[model samples]
Target: MISSDAYILGKIKEGDGNAFSLLMEKYYSVLFKYGLHITKDTDLIDDCVQDVFISLWQIRHKADSIQFIRQYLLTALKRRIIRVETQRKKTLDLHDYEFDLQFSIEDILAERQVAEDNASRLRHILDQLTSRQKEVIYLVYYLQLDHAQVAEIMHISRQSVYNLLSETIRKMKDFWENAR
Candidate 1:
C-alpha cells in the first residue's frame, strides 16, 4: 500500500530526508503539469517548482501543520510562477496573466479505457470552454479538490468557484447536445 501523506509528513518533521524525497516524488509530476497550464515557460515553471520545494524543506518543522499538502503546493507554485513572470515582464497586475489550460483528453480517456471516438468528441466539447472554465474543470474533477480549496488556489471566492463550475457544466451540456 502507498504511504499516507500524514505518515510521510511525520517522518519529514523528524528530519527524515527520504520522507521529504518521497513527498517530492509523489507530487512533482502533478505540480509540474498544473504549472504548465498556468505558464508557457517550462524553464520558469521548473525553477518555481524547485524554489517551492526548497522553501518547504526550509520549513520542514511545520509540515504537520499543513492540512492539504497538494493544495498548498499548487497554491505556492501558482503564486511563485505569477510573481516570477510579473517581475520578469515588469507587470504590476498579477491578474493580467491568462491560464493556458491545454488539456490532453485523449490521454485521460485512454487511461480509463474509453473509446477513441468518445475521446475525440469529449475533447472537442471541452475545447469550447473558456480558459477559466477549463481550469475549474481540471481543479475540481481532475485534481478532485474541494471547491473551497480550488477557490483558494485560484484566488477566487468559493461562490465564484461554484458559479464557474456550474457555467462550465451548462456549456458542456449545450455543446454535447448540439454535437449530437
Candidate 2:
C-alpha cells in the first residue's frame, strides 16, 4: 500500500513520533542526494538535513498546513544548506552562493541512442547553461517535480521556473540544429 503524505502529516501534527520517523525514513536519502547537487560535502549535507528535520519536529503543529511534504522538505533543506554554507564562508554577500547543479543528463541521452558526437555536443551546450537554467532542467526533468513544486524548492516564481526551462530547451534545440 502506498503511504499518503497527507496522512503522515496529520499524524505528525498530532505529535506522533512514529509518523515523524516514517517521514524521515522516506525523505532522508532523497534529500541527501538532492543536497549533493548543491554542494559536494556529504558530511555537511547530512548535518544540514538533520538540522532541518529537527526544526520540523520542533514545529510539528504546523505540519498539517504543509501542502506537499517533499516540496516542503526540499525547500527547507535547500535554504538550510545554503545558509550554513554562507555563514561558514563568513561573507555577508549571498550573491555568490549558487546551487551549481552538479547533475548531468548524459546517461539518459545515451539510453536514447543519441549519437556519441551529438551527446558530446549536448554536454557542451549543457555546460554553457547558467546555474539556474541547469537547476530548472534538473528539477523539472530529472526530479520530475511540477512547476509549482520546483518553484517552491527553488525559491522562485512559478513563471520563472517555466521561463528558465523554456530557455534551456531552446538552447538545447539551437545547439542540436546547428550541429546537424
Candidate 3:
C-alpha cells in the first residue's frame, strides 16, 4: 500500500498546490502534539507547527533524501521551538515560571499504582539515570538509533556515546538488582 505521505509528498514537489493540504491533513495532529510537548504553549505550539509546514513546503525537494520523515519533522519542530524560546527570553521575564518537567504528584501516584498492580518489570531502567545517560539510552533504545546517530544528535563523540551507553547499562543492571 502506498502511504498517503509518499503520495502527498510526491505531489507536493511536483508543484501541486492542493498537495500541501493533503500533507497537513495527514500530519497535523502528530505535529501539533510534538509542538505542545516542546513549547508547552498552545499559541506558540500552533505557530511552530504552521512554520514547520511552511518550511516543509518551501523545501520539498529535500523530502526524498530524508531517511526518517518523522525524525525530520521532529528536528524541524525542535529547531523552531528553540528559536521561539530564544526570542521569548530576550523580552519576557521567566522568573515566575517553574522549570519542573517532572510529572505531577497525582501522575506519579497513578504510575506507582499501575506499576504495583502489574508487578511491573523494568525492561530498561533508563529513567533512573542522569539526564545525559537517559538521553543516550532513549536515543539508542527508544529511537532505535545507532551510536553514531545518537552522538551526532547529542553533539558528542561516537566514543562518548559508547561510553555513556556502557555506563548506563551497567547502572541499570545494578538498579534492577537492588530493586529485586
Candidate 4:
C-alpha cells in the first residue's frame, strides 16, 4: 500500500484535485494549531493556513517531497504572520495608548491589574527586540520548534540559535525588572 505522502505526492504531481483536497483534510488541524500559535487569532489562523495550502498547490512542481511538506508549510505560515503583524502595527498609533498609569487599590486588585498591564507591555517589548531575537523566541517558545528546526529555518548554526535565545531571555528579563 502506498503511504499517504507518496499518494498525495503522486496525485499532486498529476494535478489531481481530489488528492489535494484529501491532503488538506489530513493536515488542516495540525496546520491550524501551528497557525494559532504564530498568528494568535483563530480567524486569521484560518486564512493563514488557507493561504499556505494555496501557495503549496500553486507551486507544487517546485516543492520538495511530502516528507518536507510540514516544514515548508510552517515556514510559510511564519512569514505570513510576520507580514500581518507588520501591517497591523503600521495602522495603529502607539502614542494613543498610555503605558504608564498611576493607581491606588488593594494588593489583590493591584496584582491583577499589574499582570494585565504586563501582558500589554510585553508585546511592546517584543516589538523592540531584533528580528532574529523575536524569531528565535517565537520558534522556541511559541511554536515549540526545537533548536535544530529554528537553525534550519533561520539559516544559522545551532549554537547561534542558542546564543540568540539566551540573549533574548536576558534582555526580556532586564526589561521587565527595569520597567517595574
Predicted structure with the largest lDDT when compared to the true one: 1
Model 2, span 88-167: residue lDDT tens: 67764433445666546667776777788877888877778888887777778877889999988887899999898898
Better of 1 and 2 by lDDT: 1
Error of 2 at 126 (Å): 1.4
Q: For candidate 2, which ten residues in a row score worst on lDDT?
A: 91-100
lDDT string, candidate 1, 125-173, tens digits:
6777777787888899889999989998988899989998998787667
Ranked by lDDT from best down, the candidates are 1, 2, 4, 3
lDDT of 4 by residue, 1-180 (tens): 766677686888778888888888877887787555445578877888899889889977754365556556666765666566667567532112211112233364366455766655665666566656766776687557778887776667999999989987887678567656
- Whose TM-score is greatest here? 2
Prediction 2 global C-alpha lDDT: 0.83
Clashing pairs in 2: none
| TM-score against native, each model | 0.82, 0.84, 0.59, 0.53
Instruction: List candidate 1 segments past 4 Å from native.
Output: 1-3, 89-94, 103-125, 177-180
Clashing pairs in 1: none
lDDT-superior candidate, 1 or 3:
1
Candidate 4 error regions (>4 Å): 1-3, 64-67, 88-147, 154-156, 162-180
Report per-prediction Cα RMSD to one decimal.
4.1, 2.9, 6.5, 9.4
Candidate 3 deviates by what RMSD?
Answer: 6.5
Candidate 3 structure quality by residue, lDDT tens digits, 56-142: 888887665555555567557666666668775665332222221222234543654535522333433433555666556655765
In candidate 3, the residue pairs with backbone N, CA or C atoms under 3 Å apart (3 or more residues apart, or in different chains) clash, namely: none
Q: Residue 69 lDDT in model 3?
A: 59
Off by over 4 Å in 3: 1-8, 17-26, 88-128, 132-165
